[model samples]
Target: MELRCKVFLRYCTCFAVIGALLVWPAPVHSAVVVIGARPYLERVAKRVVEILEGRYISGNSLPIADYVAPIQLTDKGLSITGNVSFHSAFLAKIDSIEFDAQKFSEIFLNTEVTVQGALKWHGIGVVLDFAANLEEYNGTGTLYVTYNQFDFPLKVTKPFNSTEPTGSLQFMSIDNSNKIVTVGYPNNKYVQLISRAIMTNFDFRDYMIASFRNWNFQNLLKAVIDEVPFPEVCYNC
Candidate 1:
C-alpha cells in the first residue's frame, strides 16, 4: 500500500507540472499586417525614406563623391574624349521621391537630385584639349546641376527564415535638361568650355545615375523593416 501511494503521488506531481507548463504564456512575436498592396508599399517607402533621412540626408546636404569614367564619343567626324569628376560633393536637395510598386518583388523609384560641389573636367577634342574647375565655394563660379527624372528599378527579395525583405536598387535611366544653371559670375572660361564639352560629348546623366545606384541600402532597409512588426504572411502584399 505504501509503495502504491508513493507511485500515485509521483504521478500526481508530474500531472501538476504538465498542467502548469500548458498554462504558461509563451512569448508572442509581433508581425506586420499587410492590408492593401499600395498602402503596404507606401509604408515601406516611408520607412525607406526615414532610413535615408537618418543616414544620407543631413540638414540640407547629402555627402557624396561622384566620378565619370573617361568617355569617348565621335561627333561630325570629330573625336571627343573627356572625364568628369565631382569631389567634396554633396546633394543640395532632393525635390521629391516617388515609389511605384508593381508588385511585392518589383518597385520603380523616381526622384530629382540637385548636387553642388567642386566640378572638374578634362576634355580632348579634335580642335583643342581643355580642362576646367568649378567649386561651390568659389563666389565667382558656382554651378547648379540638376538630374531630373532619375529612375531606378528595385528588386525585393525575402530570404528564407527572414521575415524582413531586402531590396537591390539598380540604375535604370536618367534625363538631364542639359541646362547648367550658373548661380554666380564666371571666373574661368575653361569651366564653360568643359561644361559644354561634357554636355555635348559625355552623358553626365549616366554618371549621376551610376553614382546614386552604388549606394547599397539593402541591409539598412532590412534592419529597419525587421524592427517594425509585420504580419508573417502578407495576403495582399
Candidate 2:
C-alpha cells in the first residue's frame, strides 16, 4: 500500500510540472531584419519628397501670416503681386520641384539621408517700394532635403531614438517586410536655416516673416511625409 502511495505522489508531481509549463509564457525571441537596409531607407526618403512636392501643387495657395522682409527697409513700401501675396496674404503655389534620388547623400544607415532638389520660384517675388520686383531664389541651385531621422514603430521590438548605426549591417534594423516607417523633420540648423531662408528670400520677403516664424518648415515636411504611404522593399525573399 505504501509503494502504491509513493507512485501516486510521483505521478501528481509530474502532472503539476507539466501544468506549470503549459501555463507559463514562452521566452520572446528578437526579430531579424533582412539586409538591404540602405536601399529601403532611400526609397522611403524619395516617397517623402514626392509627397511634399505634391502637397504644394501649382495654383494651390497657403497663407503667409508672419512674412518678413530679409533686408531692413524702413520707409520703403513693399508689396507682393502674384497668385499669392504676403502678411497674412496668400502663398501662391509653383511647379513641383523634382527630387533627385540619385544624389541622396549623407546616408546614415536607416537613420537619415539627404536629398538634392531644385526649387524654382518663378513669378513669385516681392515688389520693393512698390517698384522693383525680386522674383527668384536658389539654394545650391538645388534644395538639400535631408530626411533628418526615421523611426520604426512596428518593426523594432523597443522604442529607439539613437541615430548611431549598429551591428554588421552598420545600420539600425529595418525590416524590409514591414509596411510602415516613420520620418521626422531634421533638427540640423543648416537645414532649418535653408528652409526658412527659401521662404523668406522669395516666397514671403515683403511682409513681417518673423511674425509667422512659428510656421515651421520642419512640421510642414513632417506633415507631408505623414500623408504619403510608406514605401515597400523586398530582399532575400
Candidate 3:
C-alpha cells in the first residue's frame, strides 16, 4: 500500500493547490474589526469550517478532517476580545479514529461554544482565530465504554488570499502538561502593544501563544497508517 512519491504526486495533483485566500494593504490605523451580526457570524463560521473541512476530509484524505462544533458563541455578548471558541463537540472516543472515519464511523458533533479572540474585521467580514491549546476531551456515554483524551489542535491561517493577511504559528516551549502554540502577528499594533513588541511576525513572535504546561502521553498520539510515505499519493492501486 506504500505509494511511490511520483505516483502520489500525480494522484494528488488532481486536487487543487491549497492556500489562504486574501490580499490587502498593510494595517491601517482606522481599520478596526467589528463583530458581525449574529446571523452573519453564523454564516461566516460555517463557510470557514467548510473550507477547512473540505480540504482535510475529501481534498486529499488528510489524517484528520471533518471538524464539527456547536452553533453558538461561548460568551454572553458579542465577542471582540482576542479569540472565541464559537462551537464545540464531543466524540464517543478518540481511539476510534481512522484515516477515513467520516466515511465510516458515526461521529457526533457537539453544539457547545466558547470565545476569546478579537472580533476583528478583514474587509470581507468579522474574524476570530482560536490559536490555543486544547484541554482534556474525556469520552462519556452510558451505552459505551470509558476513555479520556484531549482534542487535537487545528490552526487556521487567514482566509483566502484576497487580504494578503498572512500569519504563522509555531510550537514553542513545552512544560509538563502543556505546549505553547505561538501565533505571531507582525503587523498588528494591538498584538505588538500587548506583547510589548515581543512577537516576531512570521517568526511567531508574540502574536498568539496557547500555552500547554502539562501534556499527557495521549496528546502525542499520532497514527501513521501509510504503507508508503510521500509528499503526495496516487490511489490507482
Best of the candidates, TM-score: 1
**lDDT for each candidate structure:** 0.46, 0.33, 0.24
lDDT of 2 by residue, 1-237 (tens): 999999999999999999999999988665323344435444444554465456633333233352323422212353322222122233333323333344333222353322222222222221111112233222121122222222211111111243322211011221121222122124333323433433334443323333223333444444433443333322223
Ranking 1 against 2 by lDDT, winner: 1
What is the Cα-based TM-score of model 2? 0.29
Worst 10 residues of 2 by lDDT: 150-159
Clashing pairs in 2: 66-209, 66-212, 67-207, 67-208, 67-209, 68-208, 68-209
Q: How accurate is candidate 1 locally (lDDT)?
A: 0.46
Better of 1 and 3 by TM-score: 1
Provide the lowest-lDDT 10-residue window in model 3.
118-127
- lDDT (10s digit) by residue, model 3, range 12-98: 765434312133355545521223323322333334334334442232222211122212122334322232121121122222211
| Alpha-carbon deviation at 147 in model 3, angstroms | 8.1
Give lDDT tens digits, candidate 1, residues 1-237.
Answer: 999999999999999999998999877775433334345445656666676656655442332444544544554554434454444445655555656554233222232111111111111011111222233221223344554455555444444355555545544555554543322125454444444544554455445445555655667657655664443343233
Against the true structure, whose lDDT is highest?
A: 1
- Measured with C-alpha atoms, the lDDT of residue 135 in candidate 2 is 35
The number of clashing residue pairs in each candidate reads: 6, 7, 50
> What's the candidate order when arranged by decreasing TM-score?
1, 2, 3
TM-scores for all predictions: 0.51, 0.29, 0.17
Q: What's the ranking of the predictions by lDDT, best on top?
A: 1, 2, 3
